[model samples]
Target: MDEHISEAIGRPDLIRLDDGLLCLRFETMKVVSALAAVSHLLDTGVVRRGDTLVDSSSGIYAYALALACHRYGMRCHIVGSTTVDHTLRTQLDILGAHLEQMPPSSSLKLDQNRRVDRVREILRENPDYHWMRQYHDDVHYLGYEAVAERIHARTGGGSLTLVGGVGSGASTGALTHYLGKRSVDVRLVGVQPYGSVTFGSGHVADPEIIIAGIGSSIPFGNVRHDLYDVLHWLAFDAALAGSVDLLRRHAVFAGLSTGAAYLAARWERREEPGRTVLFVAADTGHRYVDTVFARHQEAARVQDLAPRPVRGTHELTLPWSRMSWDGSPAPEGALLRSAAAGAGPGDGRRASKCQRSRAAGEGATSM
Candidate 1:
């Protein structure tokens, strides 16, 4: 008995895909974070029931925030990336959230920059509006604590390997953080798109589209680089193979990010036979039906595909690459500069070491 549709949608189903592999599937994952964030704002008097909240989103977060607003009796304004499709637009419209989509751009970097710029302009015009800052604020991590509890309870609190896209870091990072608090030896393997700066793969461009929700063109303040144990950078074709294989083999039709995570999880599970491996499927396959499933013929066999092991970001190559990121800090050239400089809208402060640690500490308290 969920109180709202958001609660129902946010709850994930843990499905066993193999002997040691599990899939945590969600209809739309960001709803977990969005609902908790808005409720916290209202609870703390930072925002009221009717105050408008704004942020830049590509797709999932836009719908999540809109639903959150609808549930909590608030208003949502989304500055959306060019990837926000007609389906999502229609949903936002019906949900009463305002959406301002960026003009079409082939470059994901440009699209992301435009969305952030638009958000800044909106904030200037409406100073009273609160920016959710999903990529930076640790408040988004609060909701995942309950999710972690579920995982721990189901899995019985042992050494487990968690694989998922290193998106804004709320999902995987928060899960690992809370699980570790309960003495679970959680090995976090982060999946990334080639052009994502989150883990310094921006130098190597993906010829195809950067997988929207899994990675980011700009630096995300919430991504805890040190939280990841290993990193895999998968290009569009590799992820397509993964998505196709996931559906064909396990009957789990999920988004591109899930495909990437599935591919990574399969490898990690094969490599470490002793540990239980679970990956996050952030959304369903409906959005990717045309872009991915339609071109299933071209996808490489998941059994035949593997990531090229790289010693460092400098060694990262084309279709797929993997590197050991065992508790490492952000790379030297990534958006650490922009984050420190507060280069864009909503990135109010430098994510200095002390500040990031303090944010993580505060998040732990919520758990």
Candidate 2:
């Protein structure tokens, strides 16, 4: 364990969890690991203590940075989006970190780049702020690498396919680097939401994706696209269903992104049976209780759509996209037509209808 993390989480209770699913119990330790990485960067002169650690985070990274700053006595600034959870914002404020909210833009979505731009603007206004630039920071992965090392050790360094969601792409890249150097046999698998364009896909402006902690609008310098042996993009519904399934079946309540990672792992395992497929459950799913777990509300939203069995490499459509793109008013013809016909009950057949409806609109940018 990193010295900074050891101090934060303490030694005896760091890795101990109730059921070994490693959900809520490990959060403090994860935050500690993040702090340790930041401290290491500061100690090595890669980043200075006075430098402002800036990141475009939904919540977790901001929370981590806030705690890390508290430990290192560094000022932390976050470029936050409007879509972030209100509870997370409150916690950040309590941590004494400054938040720069990015105004929504047409061409440039409320993404990491927008946050980066906001950070740049703040720095321009105050020359004293040094952007920590987590996207480009190679040291950010060192702590995550420790996790990979632990996984390898636990798994006996076997040939495994690691599946994980990409936020800054730091964790995936760092794990790939560490595992790759340790052995040439391990495969790295990256998962992203359908609308994310983090990899080489075009930019998406204000995509309505529910899965957090993955899919950035801007690309990270350290992300090794070529290193990934396989890539999978999951739909919001599939990930949502996966999360539900995990809770119902495995009794694991993981976040949507972690659910997406688990789905990808299962999908890969189905294709290549008997293969050791390891996936990281990034966070717990308690944060999404109002969204993903709200049975009645979510059902009402997708009442017009039905579930369908998706085959190989199928596109998943979101309910919001059925309305219109640019969040503009729907076409008069369709609006009038739907009103006249009246939306009917959503059966399994509505899946194809939803797919066709979204297909007519602009396709999502890949990440």
Candidate 3:
């Protein structure tokens, strides 16, 4: 392995969270595995030359897909959001991938259909464009499956508590299935921002948030709801704080959504014990320096007051009347606590509860 890759894998101290949950840090491995899987597909004649690959991606996945397409000598067209990170846009350009941005909109809400529309438009314009729909793509799941298998192998196929946010839901869904197939006792925990409608119903039913590419506005086809044993809803402020906390403590700079996943992992650690808790730092935080780290910019937005909803306590009703993907009733009480109690926490059991109160009334904030 290259030195950078080796260094990433060699960090033993880096794996354990403060709460003693084993942090899997699957982002790096997921990207590397995605590349390897694509390479394998090319070598095995699954993906041929001159194929124009199309995908609706946020930033990180776009970068990965762009690199994969370049290595495989395939033309790539990325349908991305206007709210995407500028650095990601530059990276995609450097990789020679055709980039198309969504239409302008003043609202913080991102139209999920925009990218899908672009894909349809491009495919209509060119007959050879093969849409690599990550939301429902088997290849996407295959790549994530490799990461889950590696986690299982590393832990001797032992039970673990997994937590992460969904962009396309491929990572959570695939890993859940992969681990279960190995008969490893695992609890898949899905995290989403307050404004996001991807995982659960919330006060703000926005399809997507400005965090750009971590969670979807629409429920992805591959999200196997049954696979997720627990769901944790994180607020943008808490996510931002978690990102800052990780930077201060571990020197790990990660994106806002990554921070959300981290916070969810922390929540998992507090409630459960004896089982390793794995969280995905979805992407690096360098891209979020201006947005999350800038005090001046932070001052512009109104104060966020969304109460981090816990699983128990009838004080807070389910954010939505019904679940988005399935009409199943939302869980009552503290969601994270319920999951942790059922799954069991890491070796060190520290019970930390959410001290913040809910926002005065129902109002949505732009993520």
Candidate 4:
């Protein structure tokens, strides 16, 4: 039996959607990463039970971190993104995680930058607080080791193609990293929103919102660009079509990111007829009911939709675009931009004399 609700919620269900296509669905995906990261930090003496763990999150990671803190008797203080809705705010409040959400902004970059700046400010004020840099730190990848083991056991070490959002790089990157060690021939396909800087799509802006929890406007240090074999950029309308068709055809009610992955996975399956293709459904469709599912009537036919094949990010176009990355390293252009912006690993750290001065203090009791 699971000792905590975090474990239960972190466990994912592998559902076969077709002869060669599968869906790895999670109710709340990041819980696995958050739990393992917090436990590792505590065990390694980097933090204790009571230290207030602070981080910036859009929505899912806030809830995941809150649950992790609840499991480990830590206090969580989140600098939330503008996308954080009332439902998540209520959950965070009940979970005992203090949230200070940013005012809604017109630009994604501005919103993300504001949150990062806020986290730095919080760290300076509360020097004892540890910033869980989910975008930049690799500790978040540890939890997926066991998850990869489960996937290997079920899939029987065959040639597999894994498709999912490259958000924070922990989910698809960590899973493929561990599975590769077990001799699984896995091809990683990452799905991105049009405006995400992670995969050179920052130059193109989608009129609609960038799908939350999957893509980012700022550079994420942990995104191992070499781990990805192909890339797909989907606009909101394209993702909506995929999501609507997924519910209509397969009865799987998943979020917009899942819909985008579903579309990419189907294409990969067609390209590699013998390989088993599995896509990650990071969360359920409930949060997207109004923004996505409610507008199902306008959703295009998934059968009629196809990605515009591109040679490079420069060639990326419109509603949907696909490029064969071939396991290449991070683009030189992206690296230069990151260096100029100074947004890589160790960016979130704020040194202070009071660091670890109260390691023995008792932490907040778990909810």
Candidate 5:
């Protein structure tokens, strides 16, 4: 079949946000990664005709897998968070994906925990079904090699900083590893919701924020702590302000994670004036219009009373504590937590399968 959209996946447009800041539009980057992972399953005979593809995602990865399964003729089941609303539901339905969504959780951690639990249950019942393990699998990391190559080519080896949410570690982690392999001075800055369990943030039994697709309640195996040089944690209102300001200023309607990264990257550019600071716009804001904009309509009325400024000045800069990583190996006791959580190896057996294939270099199966 002659492909169109998948062919365009991972090819990002470099948008000059400021004099030195750049926004790499990468809505389809995950699709490129997801396609590689899906193709790996099909070509390796690990999964074949009539086999189902199972994974847990908040929204974007689920949609990416849905697209891949549509093109490859495989059954897909997505265990989703409540943020997977009717808009995403309609798209997945069109792609023939069965979505089982969890109720509205106050935070991404709870949602992820529940979804991972559901995914494990499905894998147990249907052991033959190939679970994509988007969160814990190393194969997803392999999917971003081309992205790193493009960024390297785009910058022509000038010093650069990568700014993005450390979700699943596929995009940001893999990009840093690949770029660093070329001997490029890659300064990696990680952005996460204030309540994420990743990057030294203790898991809140119920975090106040639920920034999906970026922050995680659980430790992601693919996320390499050593790859990151700096980190920032943004609260819900802070990220929401950035998202709104991005649309207002740049007219680029991006997701919440993008805004968070954008805010981080903008600040980084000011701090590191000599480097070309590049950040990611993961997906469009069409999905985030409600939470990031619509629900906050009351702000207009309040704007008149206080004559409010453009963006609410939140944590534009991280405190000294948030800036420096502990330099410790693991997150206090991630192993003990994982064991008590009963999520086995890389969260589950499915992740183990993906890691094995990645180690064997099966992701490089050519066209």
Candidate 6:
């Protein structure tokens, strides 16, 4: 068959959000990560025809890797989360990807760690299986260069800002670096849930946070904090409001992280008018139907799309299109608190954690 999933993964659709901002929808922006990484591995002969491809993913990445392995004629094994449902389960089976899901973990971080542990166990049993460390791998960054290049070419490298959830540091981080290398003023607005350890957000583990694929409870090895001009610790409710609004006004059904980015991009545009702001929608709304839009109480909250003043908000906005006001910590998040005690820089604690990960043969990657 000539049809391939990887063939339609990048140069995502761009739609107008507000006066000057646009939504760089990526709910369908899967497959590119696997395609890019697998291509590099194949070209360099890292693994050949009988080798199996293995990776751990909570959702979208799992499907992408499965599609990639199928295209390349490599056997694939996915260490997945309990969150994986029957629909996706059937899809994986159809694609000939073996999947082993972790037991139901309380929090997203625990689920992720459990999946990682499963991967380790699988690797031990089959040592030849190549682990596509999507979380910490630098090769994953290559996937978004074409995306960034396309945006740069379309915008003529003028004033632009890219906003998206900071997960694995792959999409947002790589895009920022790629555009910056082309001499474009691509300001990065990184998004994370309020409870994530990323960007020094509180370490409170939110099991109720329905949003997936963004914000890490652990330190991400690939995240370059300096590359982010600003960070938004989005609350689940706020992100939900943004998503509902996206569906209602724009008819662009996207996931929660997309809403967070969309809201942030709109606020950024309001603050600095006449600037081209773009945000990424990581996935379609189908995955979030039961959690996000199906609930009646939460649906009521979505009626008010405007962002209001909150005590600890990273930024503020009005609904999806308008901006009432914005707020920030006086000193900003200059002193981000880690899981270890105390806030601020000049600490060896996080470095020690990273080093320990490297000592375990994780290839010097964070997360």
Query: How well does candidate 3 score on lDDT at residue 291?
Result: 67
Deviation in angstroms for 317 in model 5? 11
lDDT of prediction 4: 0.83
Per-residue accuracy of model 5 over 1-367 as CA lDDT, tens digit each: 5474665765677888788888888665588788878887778888886679887777788888888888788899988877777888999998899999888886555666777778778877888777777765667766677788988888898899889987766788777777877778888888776555665555332233546777665555555655666777766655666777777778888887887787778777877899999998888888777667785543222112111111211322221123644223335422222221111122321122112122211111100
Candidate 1 C-alpha lDDT tens digits along 249-330? 9999999999999999999999899999999999999989999999999999988988899999899998989998877777
Error of 2 at 205 (Å): 10
Question: Model 4: per-residue lDDT, tens digit, 1-367?
Answer: 9999999999999999999999999998999999999999999999998999988888888999999999999999998877788889998999999999899997877877777778777877898999887766678888998999999999999999999998877799888888888889999999999887778898898998888878777666566776788999999999999999989999999999999999999999999999999999999999899999999999999888899999999998889999998766666434323232222122221111111111112110110
lDDT for 75 (candidate 1): 94
Query: Which 10 consecutive positions of candidate 1 have the poorest summed lDDT?
Result: 358-367
What residue pairs are clashing in model 1? none
Better of 2 and 6 by TM-score: 6
| Model 3 ranges with Cα > 4 A deviation | 1-14, 26-46, 108-110, 202-210, 295-367
Q: Output the better candidate (4/5) by lDDT.
A: 4
Candidate 5 local lDDT, residue 172: 84
For model 3, state the Cα shift of residue 41 in Å.
5.1
> Residues 71-189, candidate 3, lDDT per residue (tens digit)?
66888888776666677788788879988877766643445565666667777788667666555434556665557667777778766877777555556656676687778887777
Clashing pairs in 5: none
Better of 3 and 6 by TM-score: 6
Q: lDDT, candidate 3, residue 146? A: 57
Give the range of the ten consecutive residues with the poorest summed lDDT in model 4: 349-358
Models, CA RMSD each: 5.1, 13.3, 10.2, 6.7, 7.6, 6.4
Count clashing residue pairs in model 3: 18
Model 6, 29-77: lDDT tens digits are 6576678888788889988855798887776888888878887888888
Question: What's the distance in Å from true for residue 226, model 3?
Answer: 0.8
